[model samples]
Target: MDLFIRYILIGIGNGAVYAALALALVLIYRTTGLLNLAQGEMALFSAYLSWWFTTHGVPIGLAIAFSILLSMIGGAVIERVLIRPVTAPGKSHLNVLIVMLGMFLAINAISQLLFSTDAEPMPKPWPSVSSPGDPVGRSARLLDIGNTSISWAVGALALTLIGLCLFLYLLLQKTKLGLALRAVASNPASARMVGINTSAMLMVGWALAAGIGALAGSMVAADRGSVSPGLMTVVLVYAFAAAALGGFDSPVGAVVGGMIVAIAESLTIGYVDALSTIELVVPFALILLVLLVRPTGLFGRRVVERV
Candidate 1:
């Protein structure tokens, strides 16, 4: 039972990171109607930027903040300069998809060129020790139940996820920008006709997604204790699976899906020795099962069209 609890806690900690990235995916899908295959790469680039900043004597928290800001601007610029042109009305979605694919590859190459292929450590934002004489100094324990211990790092991640969700909820629910974003997402032509700048909303969506991705990348890198060009690769896969399982269009679904995926992966690794060697396949298997069972996803609404 203690072992089970420990694994569960570990899964939740990992799932929180997945949830952050999944939220970014949901944000982009909601506004742009496209799955950005480069989202993880964009995050990787931002993580590199954060590492660079830290290496240059900047504080870790400030470095992460700066990176997120830069990522937001970069995301908006990419949308305006590259995506917007190709995404004009009646244009082929394939073109945009190809562009994103190209971006994924290009960004990976650029990161390697700019930051080198070597991995670098990322400083943690939270203090390592809760108090003096604590045995687990790097990650202070938040709770101890039986033999299971929950760390401050995990708590921090969970709080960050909750805070992000609340902020997004309020932004989408209460703000004028939120209404405009929803309008554009629902019907771009109608939104434009109503004087909404659909293009700007799309850009904002991309910017927000990128910013969120930066935060996710930083947190994940901190947890892993290193940053590299391939930092977000496996994470991206898991996040995609989570987003798909929860409903790509549903923010709530993303969080729930991330937790579910993490828990499932943890359980499989802990209890099923045969599958441990191929643990990476766990997320893809879940994606396949979800697709087969519910094509629209757990929280996704089925589209209804009139001929």
Candidate 2:
């Protein structure tokens, strides 16, 4: 029981990052009606920028801020330069999908070319840094119960998740910009007819999603104590599973789905001897099971079209 509880606690932090990425996925899906397969690579590149900035004497806070800002700008630029042209009315969306898939490879390769494949320590932006001589986990230990404990790093990640949830809720539910975003997401043609800038909204959506991914990716790198070109690879898989389980169009569902996936991964790996070596399968299995019952996911709105 203690072991189970410990695993759950550990999983929560990882789940939070997955939730953040899943939120990004949902955002793009809702706004553009498309899945950006290169999301993980984009995030990895953004996180790498933060790492690079820190190495060049920038404060951690400033580095993260810069990363988020740059990612948003880059996302907007990508939409304008690459996505908009392909997404033009009556244009074949197949090309855009291909572009995204191509980006997945291109971005990863670019990351490697720009910043080798070497892994380096990522500075913590949440809590104080650990001493050089201290054991890796010692400085991060935050909560303890007998032989079980949760680290400060993990707790910080959880706090970040809470912050993101609140930010998203307020932005999507209470602001004018958010209203425009929602309007566009719901019906781009209607929004365009009503004088809303549908193209601009779509750009904003990509920018926002990219910014979220940057923040999540940076925090995840800090938590893992390392930054590398392939940092978000496996996490991306879990994130996609989370998005699928929650509903690609629901932010709240993304968070819930991420937590569920992480916890499932933890408990399954911890207790099931057979699964210990194949942890990645847990998320997909859960996805398949959930999808089998609810094709639109737990919170996804079912769309009915006239045939």
Candidate 3:
């Protein structure tokens, strides 16, 4: 039971990381109706920037802030220069998807050329420079009287995710920019007709998504104690699964779905011996199961198509 609890805490932190990226995916989907396959790579690019800044005598806080800002600009530029070429009314969605695939290859190649494939340990941004240097279980403090205990890092991450979610919710609910984003998402043509700059809003959507992706990358790198060009490869799978489980178009669903997926993965790794080696497959299987039962996802709205 203690083991289970420990794994749950660790998984929760990981889930928050996945939730961050999944939120990015949800944002792009809501605005452009396309999945940005390049999200992880974009995150990797930004993380590399952060790592570079940190190595160049910059403060960690400033490094992260600068990295996020750069990523936002990169996202907006990509949307304008690359994505816009393939995106047109009544055009082929396949083309836009392919463009993103091209972007994935392009970014990966650029990273490899500039910053070799060698991975480096990412120093912690805060005082906790070293992981407690113990097994994740032993590193956590036991509860006074119960079998449950908490991991400090996990607790911190969960709190951060909650705060971010609340902020996003409030932003969407109370801000004019958020309203315009929603309008762009719900009906681009109408939004354009109403003097809303749909194209710019789409750019903003991508920029926001990229910024969120950068944050996710930074957290994952800190959690793992390293940064690599491929750092986001595995995490992206879990993020996609979380997005699918929650509802690709719903932010609240992303958070709930991320936590559920995290818990399920923890339980599976703890209880299913055969899954020990192929643990990563667990989330995909669950996503398949969920989609089989509810094609629209757990929190997705049903859509009717007219031919």
Candidate 4:
């Protein structure tokens, strides 16, 4: 029973991290009508930036902050220089997606040149809690469960997710900027007539998405005790699946989707022997099933063309 509780906690933590990044994908989709296939790469690049900062004697927290700020700016710049030109009002959105793919390639090549593809150990916030041999065994870290034994990482991840979700909700529901952003997303021409800069709003939207992606990357890498170019590969796919399952238009949906995916993955591993060996494929199959059944996703808005 205690072991089962531990697994549930761990699964929840993993779900929160997945949800964090998935929320970013949903944000871009909601605001720009483009699904950024390169969102994972962007997050991975930001994690590299944080690692670079830490390697240069900067504190981990400060490094994370700096990376987030820079990633936010990078996102805005990419939108202005690359995506904006390709996407115009009353035009097909396919070009924008293609440009994002091109941006993905450019970023990946640049990262390879700068950081190399080799995996490196990421600095952890709590490295002393566990050692090579302990009473609980190698599979479990020394988590504070009041003699019950729980995964500490899971608690931290859940708190982070809750805090971030609250922050986003406040930003969107209780601020003037959020109102303007919503207006622009709903109808750019209409928003422009009301004195809102639609282009600026789009840039801000992308910037926030990228910044959140950075946080997601940092959290996952730190928890795993390493950072690598390939780390985002699996996580990103899971995140996208979460977003699709939740309904792209609803941030709440993304969060729920993430939790569902994480639980599903955990259950599959725990119950099915064959799936235990190929865990990553589960999300891919689930995503295909969801898309085939719902098409617009669970929370995606239905579009109706007017003749």
- Please report, in order, the local distance difference test score of every candidate based on alpha carbons: 0.89, 0.88, 0.82, 0.81
Better of 3 and 4 by TM-score: 3
Candidate 1, 1-307: lDDT as tens digits? 9889878888888899899999999999999999999999999999999989998899889999999999999999998988998988799999999999999999999999998699886777766763465322376677887777788788888888999999999999899999998888777889999999888899999999999999999988887778987889988988998999999999999999999898888988999999997886887788889889999888987878789
Kindly list the per-residue Cα lDDT of model 3 for residues 1-307, writing each as its tens digit.
Answer: 7787777887898899889899999999999988889999899888877877888888766887898999999899999999998888778999998998898888977877776587866655543523465321122442333766564456656766887788778877899989999999888889999999888899999999998888778767766767787888877888888999999999988887888888878888888999897887888888899899998788987877679
- Runs in model 2 with CA error above 4 Å? 133-139, 145-147
Clashes of each: 0, 0, 0, 1
Better of 1 and 2 by lDDT: 1
Score candidate 2 by lDDT. Answer: 0.88
Give me the runs in candidate 3 sitting further than 4 Å from their true place.
129-149, 305-307
lDDT-better candidate, 1 vs 3: 1
Better of 2 and 3 by TM-score: 2
Task: State candidate 1's TM-score.
Answer: 0.94
The best candidate in terms of lDDT: 1
Quote each prediction's TM-score.
0.94, 0.95, 0.91, 0.89
Candidate 1: stretches off by over 4 Å:
129-137
lDDT of 2 by residue, 1-112 (tens): 8877888987898899999999998999999989888899999998889988998999877999999999999999988998888887788889899999988899999988
Per-residue lDDT tens digits of candidate 4, residues 66-101?
999999999999889888887876767777778878
Worst window of 10 by summed lDDT in candidate 1: 128-137
Better of 1 and 4 by lDDT: 1
Error of 2 at 94 (Å): 2.3
